[model samples]
Target: MGKLYVVGIGPGGLQHMTVRARQVIEESEVIVGYTKYIDFIAPLIENKEVFSTGMMKEEERCREALRLSKDKIVSIISTGDAGIYGMAGLVLELIENEQVEIVPGVTASSAAASILGAPIMHDSCNISLSDLMTPYELIKKRVEAAAQADFVITLYNPKSKGRPHYLKENIETIKKYRNGNTPVAVVKNALREGQEYEIFTLDSFDDSNVDMLSVVLIGNSQSFVKNGVFITPRGYKL
Candidate 1:
C-alpha cells in the first residue's frame, strides 16, 4: 500500500524543518498544504506536484492527500507541530490515518518558550484567540478559566484581519483572573530568522507587536525573566 507522511514544517523557514521532516519530504512524490506552507517546502521536491489552498479547507486538503496516498507517496505539510492545531487532526478525521506517519517539528510554542528561556517549564494552557470557529464567549470562558486555574497561557493566532478585536478581549478575560502585572512574553518568527522576542508585564503589551506568526506566553504567578531571559519556574531543575 502507498504511504503518507503528515509533516510539520515548523514555522515559516526551511531551517526549522526537522531532519525527519526533510527526509520524508525528500521521499514524497506529492506535497499538499496551504500556499505559504507549500512555499516553505517547494524547494525540497524534485518536480513533485503541490496542492495548495486557503483557510478552512483542511478536509479538502487532507482528502486530496489521502487519495494520492492510496497509490503514491505523499506528505501533507503544517506550519508547527502536527498535533497542535496541525494537519494530523484533519487528516485523521478525513481518512484512516493509520496509513500515514506523523513527523513532528519544532512547534511555535516550544520555539517561543526556548527563546524566552522556558515559561512553560511548568504546565501551561494554550488558547487560540481566533474565534471564527469557536465561539467568542467560549474562548473568553476558557481564558478566564486558565487564568483562574493559575496556569500560564500561550495565545495562538492572537490577531488577524477579520478578527482584530479578539486579542484585546482575550487579554481582558485573562485580567479577570490574573493580575494586571502578570508576566507575558511574545515570540515572533522564532528560530527561522527575523525572530523577535519580547518579555514584559501583561499591562504593557502593545497589540501592534503581535501577528499571526507569533506565540504569546503569559506567565503564571511564578514566571520571571532574568539575565535578559523570561522564565517560568518548573520546580524541578535549577
Candidate 2:
C-alpha cells in the first residue's frame, strides 16, 4: 500500500512552499492538482510525475488521486492552507487504510492581512463569496451574518468575469450589517511582487475595480486605519 500526502504549498511560486511540503513532494511518485495550480509548482518536481485537471472537476481529480495512491506514492496539492476550502476537504472523503497527511501552509488571507497591517488581529471569520455551488441566498446570509456578528471578514471569490458582480453583492451585504464607513482592505495577489493593496472606506468601494484574483477584508466596527493600513485587532492589547 502507498501513502498519500495532501499538501498546501501556499499561494504562488516555489518560495512559499514549506520545508515539509517540499520534502513530501520530492518523495512522492505522483503529484496531482488542478492544472494551473500544478503549473505553479511544476518546476519543483521536474523529476516526478504530474497529473492535473483543467478547471472545475475537482471531485474527479480527487478520485484519480485516490486511485493513484493504490499504486504509487502521491501528493495532492492545493494552494494555501488545505483546510480552508482547499483540496483537503475533497480528499478527506477518499481516505482509506492508507495514511493521509495534511501539511499546512500560509493561506492568502493571512498573508494579505499581514501586508495590509493587522486587520484580523482579533476575532474574524473568513468567508468565500463564490456561490458556484452554494445558493446565492446562503452566501448572502453568511456575508450578512459575518458582518453583523462584528467579525473581521475575509472574503474570497469576490469577482470573476463569468460571475462579475459578486463584489457588488458582497458590498451590498456588508452595507446591510455595518455602517457605510467600515474600513476595508482590498489586496491583489498578496506577497507576489508588485502586489497591490488599497484601504477603502466601505461607502466608497468601486465594484468594477475589484476582481476574482483579489482578496477582500472588511473590518469590524473596531477595525481601524493605521499608517494607511486597515486593521481589525485580535483583541490582544499591549
Candidate 3:
C-alpha cells in the first residue's frame, strides 16, 4: 500500500511552509486540496497530478485522496497546520485503520501573531466563529469561557458574508469579561501576498474588516499596545 501524507502549507505561501511539507509534496505522485490551496502551491505541483474542489467539498476531497493513496503516493494539503481546523482530522476519521503521516506546519494563529507582535505571549486558546460543522450556541459558550478565563483568544473563520454578524456578537460577549480598551488585532492573508493587518481596541473593532481570510486575536486583561505593537506579557520580571 502506498503512503498517504497530510501536509499543512502554512498561510498560503511557499516561504511559510516547512521544508518537510515541501519535500513530501514533491515526493508524492498525486496532490489533493481545496482549489485555492492548490493554487497556493501551483509552482511545486506542475508535474504532479492534482485534484481540487471548491469550498464546502472537504469530504469529497478527503475521500478522493484516500482512494488515490490506496495505489499511488498522495499528499493532501491544507492551509496552516492540517491538524488545526484542517484536513488531518477528517482524513483520519475516514480511514481509521490506515497508516498515514501528518506533517505539521505554521498554523494561522502563529503567523498572525508574529505579524501583530506578541499578542499571544501568555496563555492562549483558539476558537472558530464558523458554525458550519459546529453549532453557534456551542461556539458562543466556548468564547465566553475563554474570555472569562483571561486567555488570549485567536478566532478562526471569524466572519463571512453569510454570517456577517457572528464576529460582532462574539466581540460583545468578550466585552463582558474584557475591558473596552483591551487590544485586538485583525490580520488578513498573513505571510501571503496582499497581506494586511490593523489593531483595535475591544470596543472600537469594526467587524466590517473581517472575513474568512482574516484571523482575529483578542488580548487578555493584562495585554497592552505601545508604539502600535500589541503585546501580552508572559509574567517575566523586567
RMSD of each: 1.8, 1.6, 0.9
The segments of candidate 1 whose C-alpha lies over 4 angstroms from its true place after superposition are 96-98, 236-238
| Per-residue accuracy of model 3 over 1-238 as CA lDDT, tens digit each | 7878999999998998999999999999999999999999999999999999999999999998998888889999999999999999999999955558999999999999999899999999999998999999999999999999999999999998889899999999999999999999999999999899999999889877888999999999999999899999999899
**lDDT (Cα, 0-100) at 160 in candidate 1:** 85
True-vs-predicted CA distance for residue 16, candidate 2, Å: 2.2
Provide the overall lDDT of each model, using Cα atoms, as 2-decimal numbers: 0.84, 0.83, 0.94
Better of 2 and 3 by lDDT: 3
- Candidate 2: regions farther than 4 A off: 236-238
Best by lDDT: 3
The C-alpha stretches of model 3 lying farther than 4 A from their native spots are: none
Best-performing candidate as measured by TM-score: 3
What value does the lDDT take at residue 183 in candidate 1?
Answer: 79
Backbone clashes in model 3, listed as residue pairs: none
Native-referenced Cα lDDT, model 2: 0.83
For candidate 3, what is the TM-score? 0.98
Colliding pairs, model 1? 10-79
TM-scores for all predictions: 0.93, 0.93, 0.98
Candidate 2 residue lDDT tens string, 41-92: 8788888888888878889888888888987999998888888878897788
